[model samples]
Target chain A: MLIRKPADIPPSEITPRSTYVERRRFLGKLASVGGVGGVSGMSGMSGVGALAMAAMSWRPGDAVAEVGAGSLGALVKSAHSTNETPNSLHDISHYNNFYEFGVDKAAPAAQAHTLVTRPWTVRVEGLVKKPRQIAIEDILKLAPLEERIYRLRCVEGWSMVIPWVGFPLERLIRWAEPLSDAKFVEFVSLHDPKQMPGQLFPVLRWPYVEGLRLDEAMHPLALLAVGLYGDILPKQNGAPLRIVVPWKYGFKSGKSIVALRFVAQQPVTSWMRAAPSEYGFYSNVNPDVDHPRWSQARERRIGEFGKRKTLPFNGYGEQVAGLYAGMDLRKQF
Target chain B: MWAGRVAKPSAAWLARIKVALFLACLLPTVLLALGVYQDRLGPNPIEVVTRGTGEWTLRLLLITLTVTPLCRSSGWKWLMRMRRMLGLFAFYYALLHLGSYLWLDQFFDWGAIGRDILKRPFITVGVAAFMLLVPLAATSNQAMVRRLGGRRWLRLHRSVYLIAILAVTHFWWLVKRDITEPVVYASILAVLLGMRLPLHRWGQARTQAAAKGRARVTGPAWPRNP
Candidate 1:
């Protein structure tokens, strides 16, 4: 009897950057030369023989770029960030939590690349001295981009440690120069129905909106990430530019942002509007404050099997706990 | 009496159908095992197992609901014999779904599980639905049905409709955005429940008419036509 254990193949290793595209082309030529029998023989007549044959027939159309590999900056070490092992680029690319592209966790990974990020402009308005439309390129030049490894905790009980490349959001806020009356900062995402299919349905109000206290926005820990893991941020991971508030839930960090408004009154966010009780405006990662669906006490880190105990403020309690001082997290959550 | 005269299904036929139903019910579990063994459950195996079992549980429940309407409309009275088996299969899948969540997903964290059931609306409804299934599954046999008379047995089983609603609601609220799948399931359940109303009366009338026709054809001859 031939006993064969299925080989554990890391997708990142199998399909790295441009290599996967080249391999697909090579496989296509090979398949043309010889069909199923050749595939079987090449795969050593293993249990995965059929898969090898299927792989040969697979085209390289919709070729996904492997992001988060640029060595533009030295790795960042922050007291707030944990030393936990980061999830692989492949897992980060494929296993997404972005709902703009689609509801399924994997949907954004597959669909978000179609989104246009280049030639993007953001309107900085509301309670500012100069309300200007700044190009994304100019936004990148607003401050020198640095590497910052942060742990992102999703409200859905999953977390990921990502090495992001961006400057402190405060720099941009400082540049915008909010007036004294500016109490809250509202962020609006791109609202193209044709590109983001999820927006077509009434699952959520379009132009996915999120907000933060003006003070929270100006916090040094708040980041407007342009890239991840030393490379240009993948479209799925919110390319061009996106907010990265490590202390809050992943949804709080709006993606492909198009507008920033400094408002007097607190803004109602997309999720907050959709289900007020379930998602609060201040979606701070509090393990004690469970979501209406699941416990936040523990979170499954991407690429890992076992779950780790969730930290208050996603392990940035020292930095962000002060922002919510004297406030009841249970009610806010 | 019409019951004895209707001709009970042969023991061998019953045995064969039971075996077939058993194997058919086992198919999903087998495929799930094969999938796990093959590492085909995508990135999150626990999630795949959890959702897969939950979906199967709902599907089997719907299938069990279909059996009554199917038998009534088609006049395949013998189909009634399979309803208990189908119901048990549904219970079995529900058990697997719960087990997958408890063991695989939660790692048997009883306190957390308890908290989730109390806190989460979806989990609360799902737990209620599964709990309601327990008594019905336990009393599925003839002895227990006889122990608690037909009316009480029927009243207990009628909770299946409530369970179906809770199960559907459980699925509906869990999803972040896409409601298409839950809506489809809810529609199927609605049709199934709808059949039990006016359709039930129509089916009963048709069934009685068919039985009377059979009675006339196969003779009782006692008070015939008098």
Candidate 2:
């Protein structure tokens, strides 16, 4: 392990209340400085290229300084601290990492424009008292977007600090009132290969699926993001709706969502079904549980120059840490 | 080849066709290299270039292999003249594709690069294809041909069949999804192999039947005088 000294940073350390107002102020400045620039300009694309090239190496805490506490907001909630929410999760319901439309990380930002997010409805059925179709617009009106900058980790071992905008997922589940039989919440994405080229892959079937334990789904850290970067959710980023589970690998927080089903048994996930030995539920980023192939100890924090130290529960241990206090993460993994 | 060198050159039309065929074999490689240099190889240029060079390498090899049957069947002996050039082009792109992976992905760090070549299944197959190409490339010249003689030269270059198979396997393993491209290359290779079997048989049968009928009549002198 490489030890880093925070004293290396030239500025005063941030502590106490890291509030929404402060995040907004910082976000505004970061938009001008840190953003690759709005997707509209060619300079912005070059900016992405330039960053990808320069970021081959890194200095510690560069992301925290640039993007702010990133996943700290949602993690703080997971940490069960009411005082701080993530500042980077500016608009969470939408910003996503779907690459089916194209290969560019930013492609989803534009390619998702081809998708129709309206006139949308979700069939919340299976072991639920309220097995009904709910208009997405009505669902949006259920609660206003709030900020939760969650630590996002990918199976590929890279990560990003995203400030997502949405209400706690538990809020809606409580209002819907699942019966005692409901044990899992399975999510389904739009599966058309014509729309999602990832489906055409003989490697893995399309219409990606994800699931979580009902109790885990209700955990305060789980969110239904509505927007990002202070804008309505971009279509490519699962516009209109998506889930954010702050502590797990990114795939568990599925994208381009079309359905959410409450099931009694644990649902089979596509990645797990494709390669069972490699992926597992409770895919919490436990540094001790190495993936079949890679080390989970360190991750490339995207939007930052180099790799960062991975924390227990992605640095959210103060709250949800005790939830797994006695459990063996390696077994669950 | 010793006696053939003393014979007059083939017709003018044959020479022009040989030149045209060489240009055709070279054009895609030149275009692909241009695409690589300019970073115009397409979105995810590394993956695109990877697939492109690999596919062309297999295709040129198939064409070079087919020259034997095509020349025999069409009775165009001149078709053999273009075979060596096409075989070399296949090697040229195969080397470029392997070099790109080493230079760009591995950054030429011999240790990690060696680990990738040794540890990964796909990389191992790809390296095997490259090693097979080395003998074919070396013997492609006239001096080596004279030294090895035609029979030994043909036997050594038979490694082309195995190289094409290994290249296809390398392609199949690299893709995370959509193996249609690799499957298509595999199908073409299978057909190219099929074209060789009856071809050598039919050519030899024609040569021997002429000699056989004359021998049956007079217990073996020559055919035309009778």
Candidate 3:
């Protein structure tokens, strides 16, 4: 009998969110019973089975108070499972690599509370017909918000499944109406040293900036996320607004985004500028193209004990691979 | 009197001290093992194990480097006996550190491990530091020392300084941005290396001068030929 591969299984036949989450808890219980033997216990299941069973069980009833006032969690659509379990809320929020906050994985969670995201304004400029600094509130009203669960693969060889609430980046880009010459979309993050203590040290030329080619930015998979896990975004997790490029490394999805500029040339990203050899501008999640410092072939999912092989374009190849069609990913990476 | 007592520790006392030091050196590994057995290494236990082992290796390397200078400064010659054990412990921790990387991180994937050692600068320096320690550890025994002779053995062990430098560099290069830990280690190693330069020469010169004074006390009355 021919077994159907997970990728080949139609969305209609996929497991329900409730069943998927229940199976995950069951597996998690089984794993704990195996008593911390690393990934061996979790490895009993196939990688794809584990990925689909990895969703966090946060529902509408769990800590509604933590959702924060005026949160967009209510507006979030029901689960459209990305076929990958998201990192636990604790793991997703705690284990971050936001250099603007500090270098340690825990620093962002500790230090990002000081960030004032309420009065945030996102400036849209450079090669756009209309240059404006839209108020955070006004930007929220610009387009209808939608929930999307996307896989975030970090360049440091770790990954997370994040349930993001936002609208397509193309909506905002279209609203700005880019000039004919605009070939790239540059994202600039808030650079307040007072709010972000890590800015006191020159980790990377601050006001951390990242960029994407215009087509990549306009892709349907690209999201301008305002919240995660059906709640207001935590400051550490890039509160107010941030980019979510599911196919690229986590660093490429700049946090605490304050500006979006359409440029004629490729913009210098913070990581790419700091270490040109280690981080390329494109920085797509390609396992075959190893990082100069570590192999990108495998990534430790945030909550899992074992590492799983990294997928091409972070398992979104069908949705996003067409953008990089004839290009040498190894060279570009 | 206390200084004199420190200078001339009895054989039994030294033996007891050696055993205590050995157990003290083993404490981190013991606690780490307990943590593993009890499942208390937090969410990322492999990382905890890897980093803990790596840190112990670096700490032991620094401890090994301190032996000679400490012996010179305090005039406690017996302290030199602890050097071999300290060096061996450093190698033990280094082996555990590499084992964690090879077994836990790389899962004995030779191709991936080889690529990491070759491509990553930090890993390269780390591998270099570990390789340099192998010879020092191999010749640490009395029989090997006798075979190699004192002069050759001393020369071989001096590479520990280089290993310390490389080990510190490996750590410094591994971090993404905040380097407070590696910086502290670098500062300590720098001072240790510096203390050995003129102070070490002064120590040798004083020993030679004392030897000359002893020769004068025991020399023949008639100083015939010059």
Find the candidate with the highest lDDT and give its number.
Answer: 3
Q: Point out where model 1 deviates above 4 Å.
A: A1-80, B1-24, B76-82, B119-121, B141-156, B202-226
Q: Which one is best on DockQ?
A: 3
Higher-TM-score candidate of 1 and 2: 1
B1-226 per-residue lDDT for model 1 (tens digits): 5554344567786788789988999888777765544445555655776788899999989998998778666665667777888889899889889887786568889998887888888999999999999998999898897898866887788889999999999999898766899999999999999878886565467658778885333322111100
| Sequence-dependent TM-score of model 1 | 0.78
TM-score for the first chain in candidate 3 comes to 0.84
Q: How much is B101 displaced in model 3, in angstroms?
A: 0.9
Q: What TM value does model 3 have?
A: 0.83
| A1-333 per-residue lDDT for model 2 (tens digits) | 122222122212224333443544344334323322321122334655645533432333443354443331332222222232333432222234575675435456556666777778766777788787778777776765575556677666566656566778876676566789888888887777776664555455566789988877887778887765445566766767888887788878877677778888888887788778878977887777766544576665433323566777776665466557688888888
- TM-score of A-chain in each prediction? 0.78, 0.71, 0.84
Candidate 1 CAPRI assessment class: incorrect
Candidates ranked by DockQ:
3, 1, 2
lDDT of 2 at A113: 62
CA deviation > 4 Å runs, candidate 3 = A1-71, A75-81, B1-20, B34-42, B142-148, B177-180, B199-226
Can you rank all candidates by TM-score, best first?
3, 1, 2
| DockQ, every prediction | 0.18, 0.09, 0.25
Candidate 3 per-residue lDDT, tens place, A1-333, comes to: 122122433445545444554455455534533433342222354544433433332243433333335456455442333756555465578778888788877789999989999888888999999898888888888887886767888887777777788988998899888999999999999998999999999879998999999999988778988987667888899988999998899889989998898999988888888989888999999989987767789997765766899999888787678888899998988
